[model samples]
Structures are given as C-alpha cells and as structure tokens.
Target: MSDHVEEQEMEAEALEAIFDVSFSVVHDAQPFVWSVRLVPVDCGGDESEELEHNHVAVKLVATIPPTYPEDCGPELDVEIERGLAEQHREEILGVARDEADANEGMPAIFAVCEAVRGWLADNNEKGLEDVSMHAQMMRKKKDEERSKAKQEQKFESQKKAEEMTEAELEEIAVRKRRADGTPCTEENFLAWKEQFDKEMEEEAAREVAEREREGGSNKKKGAATEIKSRRDAEREGRPTGYELFSGKAGTMNLEALEAAAEEAEEGSDEDDAVTVEDLDVDENLFDDDDDLDDLDFDDDDCDEEEPEI
Candidate 1:
C-alpha cells in the first residue's frame, strides 16, 4: 500500500511487542485501529515496588487515517479503566492530542503513548481531587461571566435612555401603554387626567407665589433709584426708566449698559452690546411665545371648548 499505511503497520507491531498483554489490535482493515492500556507508575516507590492501592489505568484507542504521520494526525480516544473520574480521562486525552500534533508527519504513536504515561505519572497522587476542584472553579467562572454580561447590558440600556433628547423622553413618557405593555383604558385616563390637573394647579400657585415674593423684594429696594426689573416691565408691557433714556427700550437694560461701559472703559467699542453671553435672561419668559404678550386676553377670547370625556 502507501508508505503511510506501511509505517502504521510497523508502529502497531512495535506497540504490541512493547506492551504485550496491555496492547491489542482493534481492527486490521485498510484503516488500522489499535488500543493500549497504560498503568500509572508509583513515582514515590522504586521500580520494583508494587503500584499504590489508588493506582488507576487508562486506555488509548488510535484510529489510523489513510494519511496519518504524513499529512495529518490519527483520531485518538481515551478511557479510564477504574478509580479515576471522567475529567481525568479527558485531561490525559488532551495531552495525547497535543503530542500527536507535535509529532505530525512522522511516527507519533510511541511519542503520544509516552506523553500520556508521563502525565499519569505526574498526576498519579492527586488526579481525582485536582480535576474535581478544576471543574468547580470553571463552573463558578462561567456563572460570573454570565452575570457580568447581564449587568453590562443593563448599563448600556440605561446610558442610551440618558442620552435621549428631552422631546424623545417626553414622547416615551406619553405612551398610552403601561410598563407591562397593557393599553390604557378610559378609567385609567380619567384618573391620570385628574391627578395631572391637580399637579398643574399646584405648580401654577407655586409660580404666582414666587413672582409675588420677587415683587415684594423689588418694592423693598426703592422702585425709582434702582429701575424696574425686566419681569415687572415685561408684565406691565412698558420700558424701565433707564430704557426710556437709552433709546434701547425692549432691547437693552441696566446689565447690558454696565457690561458695555466696562468694555468701553477697558478700551473696546463693539456695537453688539446685548448678547446672551452677557446676560442672564429668564427662560420662563419665552415659554408662551405669543407675539401679543403686550395685549390682554379674556377666557371668552378662545372659541374651542374642552372635549367631553
């Protein structure tokens, strides 16, 4: 046959001669198969001493492929005779696979068998305990990784929500469904509407109280000497005393004048005197952007009526 098949036969014969009773031909067809049983050495005892009471044996089955020892490695399987756990058998098989790969494109069965024998000798004393501990540690590590991945996913979802715009957040909040995906009913809507109206009334009362407090503070600070504040002037739809003199009414104010004088006194003449960066305007004043803030409207000015629930 091929040179690879001839080399395989020679290796099998050598193994049989070497192992004697421990080695046997499993199949002798075109693709040869054989098995060898390995006994662990008593490392602590002399060569002539008998094996320890806890001695264990493993069986290695080698299936020679058509191109073994030339282009690829043989298919190897390992089995423990007794005493040792299955994980130990797997660990020894891994050693055999590594040895086979290291000796590719040459006679490798002897090298793999010797490697396995060395592993058994090295781990003979504590093989079962070590394997059990290793399995437990691996299970714990896998569980921790699973939990960490879930926590990372949750953090990413929260971060995404935080990055959403205010309008997007409000849209999500306005969804008609509950957290569990149930649709809102009329009773639920009515209850929510009542609570929402109550909250709005309370908020309006708080705003009115805040404005009255500010007005009282302004009154205590003499009205003429200091000039009317922007909020009072906006509410009255007229200019302050400073605005009446500067010809910049509705546009400039005391703050802008002070900023401009500071800039000019420090030797600059920029024409844009009132910039957003130079002022701390109240954002609430722009909330209702109707151009007719100067005009007064009664409740009867609106024609649309609220829809009947």
Candidate 2:
C-alpha cells in the first residue's frame, strides 16, 4: 500500500510539473497552450543477445490558439492569440527558456516548451499598429473638415452682419431724407421731384455746356485766312470770268475771229442777195413825195413879211 501511495505521489508530481510547464508556456505565449506527455524509453542496448531497457520516455505536443479578430467575443480571442504570437515572441521564448532551465533533464517539459514555441511561430497575429494608424488619420481628416466648416460659417456670419449694417444705413438715410415736408407719393412727389430733378439736370447740363464753351473760348485761334476779292484776284494775275469762260482770251488767234466774222458776213450776204426783180414795188411812193413838195412853197413869202415888221 505504501508503494502504491508513492507511485501516486510520483504521478501527481509529474502531472504538476507538466501542468506548470504548459501553463508557463501558454501564459508567455499568451493565448496558446501546450500538451505534454511522459513515455517509457529504453536507454540500455543489448550486448551478446541480451537487451537492456531504459525506464521512460516523454513527448510534448502543442497547438497554437487561433488568431483573434478586432471584434467582440470569439473574434477577440483569436485576435488576442495572434497579438500574443507577434507582439510577444520574445516573452514566449523567455518562458520556454525558463521552463527548460527549471526542468532540466525533463524531456516532457522541454518538449512542451518547444512545441509551444513552434505553435507560436506558426500562428502570427496581424499587427494592430496599422489599424491604429488608420484610425488616427481618419480622426485628423475629420478634424480638418470640421475646422473648415467652422471657418466657412464664421465668414458667412460676418458677411451677413455687414449686409445688415449696410441695409440699416440705407434705411436711416431714407428716413432722414423723408423727414421734411416733401411728399413721397407717386403723383405729387414725382411732380415736385421731377421739377427738382429737371432743374438739377438743367444745371448739370448748363455746367457741362459752360465747361465746353469755356474750353472752346480758352482755345487759341488760328490766323485769319485772307480771301481775295474778284478785282484783287484779277490784279494778282488770276483768271477773270471772261478769261475763264473764253479759254485764254488774249491768246485767241485772229484767224479764228476772222473765220467766224466771215461766216457771219456770208450769212448776211445770203439775206442781201434778193433781186429787185423778185420783189413787188409800192405804186404810191411817187405821189406821197409830190404832195409833200406842193405844201412847202408858201414858207419864204411868210418869213419876208415878218422880217419887215
């Protein structure tokens, strides 16, 4: 019975040792676990056809935890496993080293640590740094957008304020201008305003006109251009009307005038060429002369009596 109790204590010790190594490896590998075993092994070889056997053998098996996701529940577990593999490789190695040192010559513990290390190597986690960086960048972009919107809103408010101020100023000016007895109706105001506007427009027009007149008056006059009289023009050897009409009157050839006069004389001679034999003569012509001679005979006798008186 004591031998059985000793055996049971040995088993318990073995189990405790195994559990410690596995738990250490798992904790350091943070989310991975190791499976350990102890097996009998023969260490002594037969000589001369006799076989010598060793007492026991040990083996270790390990399975790395599945990678974790960045979400709740099982996914988080997987993510934890992966994160442990990548971020805590050194820690896992340290745990294996410590367990190996503590359980020197214990093949089961060594094998367990080796298996856990191998599992950790096989199951590496994706780095969370990249996700963190992306989140930071998004945050920065959102902040920038918010800042720009705020600035735009501020500028719009300022612009509206300025417009309101301008409107108030315009209203004040209108009110002040309307405070007088001037009627603001379409008919009465338009008539009175039309007269005032017409006067103002006329004054402006007169000012413009006066400016133009002053500008004209201030301009220097050019010298008076002398125009020659007809006589003066003639005295200056310029062309007269007859000279202009007759084509160089003094230079006309006498032969041309003689030819023209000869033409005229020829025309006259044509008229004078009528013969008296071709004409009818008046028959009373000798009687009219005889009557005039007979009346003239008493003139000398009346003149001699007047001379004696």
Candidate 3:
C-alpha cells in the first residue's frame, strides 16, 4: 500500500474509535470519505437551564487525496445537521481548513475536529455575553420610553390648552372658581398666593434674625456698662449698691463717707430735717443698761451739726 493511503486509513480508524457511533465512512476507496460529529467543549454550568444556551454539533466531512499527509492536506467541509447559523458554519469550516493546513505532512483529522469544537465553545460564550448586553439595552430602552411618555403627556396637555376656545377657557375658569365666587385666573390668585407666602416667610426669617441680633447686642452692651460702672465706682472710691445692701457699707473709705454725708445734708430742706424729738424709736427695744451718756461724741460734732430751723 502507498504511504499516503496507509496514513489515511490509520486516521479513519482512530477517528472511528474515538467518536464511536458519531463517526461514519461514506466511501472506502482511493479518495476515502468519512464524517465525524463534532461537539463543543463543556462550558461549566447547567446549560439546560440557561436561556441563551446553544449546543453545537457540527458534522465535519473529510476527503483524503492521493497526496494526503505528504505535500497536501485533506479536502474538508462542514455540515450543520442539527442546525447552526450560516455565519458560524462558515467560520467553523474556516477554522477546520486552517487546522488541516497547519498539520500538512501529518494526520490532521483530530486537530481539525478539536479546532471546530473550540470555535463553537468560544462562540457560545460570546452569544451568552451578547444576551446580557441585550438585556441591558432593553432596560435602557424602557427607561427612555417612560421618559418619552412623560414628555408626550406634557405636550398633549399643552396642545389641549391651546385648542381650547375662548368660551371654553372661560367656562373652565368659572368651574375652578374659589369659594368666594371669584375666578382664580381673574387675579392670578395662585401666583399671588405663592409670592405672598414666600415674602411672608422671608419677612418672618428677617424679623427673627433682627431680634436675635439686637438681643445679643443689648446683652453685650449691658454687660459692658455694668463692668464699666463697677470699675468707675472702685476707682472713684465710692460705695457700690451691692456693698451698701450687703452690710459692707464700711468698705467705703472715710473720705467718700464724709463727702456722701455732707451731700445728703445739703440736699435736705429745713422742713425735711429731723430733730432728736422727731425720732419715733420705742427706746424700750434697748436694754436698761444702754445709756445716751455712754455714746462717744467728737468735740467738733456739734460745730458740724445743723441747727434747728
């Protein structure tokens, strides 16, 4: 037997053993013809549950030439018996042919079958991806349609308004009359009310802000005035109201005390002055041991004292 014929026979036997029932010999002559069903590689998933699942089983036909496995490769054709896209069928044929070409001077049936299977697997994955992309596109289309519907509704409303006759517009205004029998459009009441509410809120906010500002200013001013008054009283050597009321009257210097007593005497009228007899002291509130003679009097106290009117 010829070397090329032997090689072809060996390839046919190997393919039949590997593929079993799926492999068939059409002609067993000088130009041998056989077909092998090609199944794609497994894509790890429950493919039966997938919506975009596509399982490929292409029949690859090969014809061995006299120059097979030597100077030339086998003639190859693809038959999609189970059904596949024409584009994919052509692409599978191209891949098989390319594999055969690469295995020139060698048995290429197994390599060609594997190449076609790989192509089917890769294309199946791409189709699944395309399905995902299609879902996204559909979602986007729905959103656009909703938006368009809204716009169309608005356009229809405007068109209806434009198509209304003058009398129909008047009737609508009458039907929308307020409880006081005044049409809303007669004075643009809604617009005016909106503006009025906005202005009122702005005014109220301004008033609140003004009151807060003034209150803070007055508080600071009162605090500063109180502090300045205390400082002045201390520097001028005078009694503060707190000192007088809190039994700290002696805290005032003698000079300030004397000056204050003299000012009080000068401010008093003769009729308002009290004599010793004018005092209504009970005198019994004191103990019997208390005596007027025990009171110490300064020698110049009489000279400084005011005389009776």
Work out the TM-score per prediction: 0.39, 0.15, 0.37
Best by lDDT: 1
Which 10 consecutive positions of candidate 3 have the poorest summed lDDT?
A: 122-131
lDDT rank order: 1, 3, 2
Estimate, for each residue in 72-113, the C-alpha lDDT of model 2 and write its tens digit. Answer: 111011122223333344444444555544543333344433
**Residue 302 in candidate 3 has what lDDT?**
32
Write one digit per residue (lDDT tens) for candidate 3, span 84-203. 656667878999999998988888999998888887665443322233567558746766987899999999999998999999989888787743485558469878998999999999
Off by over 4 Å in 1: 42-54, 126-309
**Candidate 2's error at 152, in angstroms?**
50
Q: Which lDDT tens digits does candidate 1 get at residues 37-99? A: 876653433334535543666889999888887888889999887557777777888999999
Worst 10 residues of 2 by lDDT: 69-78
Residue pairs in collision within model 3: none
Q: Return whichever of 1 and 2 wins on lDDT.
A: 1
Candidate 3, position 15, lDDT: 91
**How far off is residue 263 in model 3, in Å?**
99
Reference-based lDDT, each prediction: 0.74, 0.45, 0.73
Pairs that collide, model 1: none
lDDT of 2: 0.45
Where in model 3 is the C-alpha error above 4 Å?
41-54, 125-309
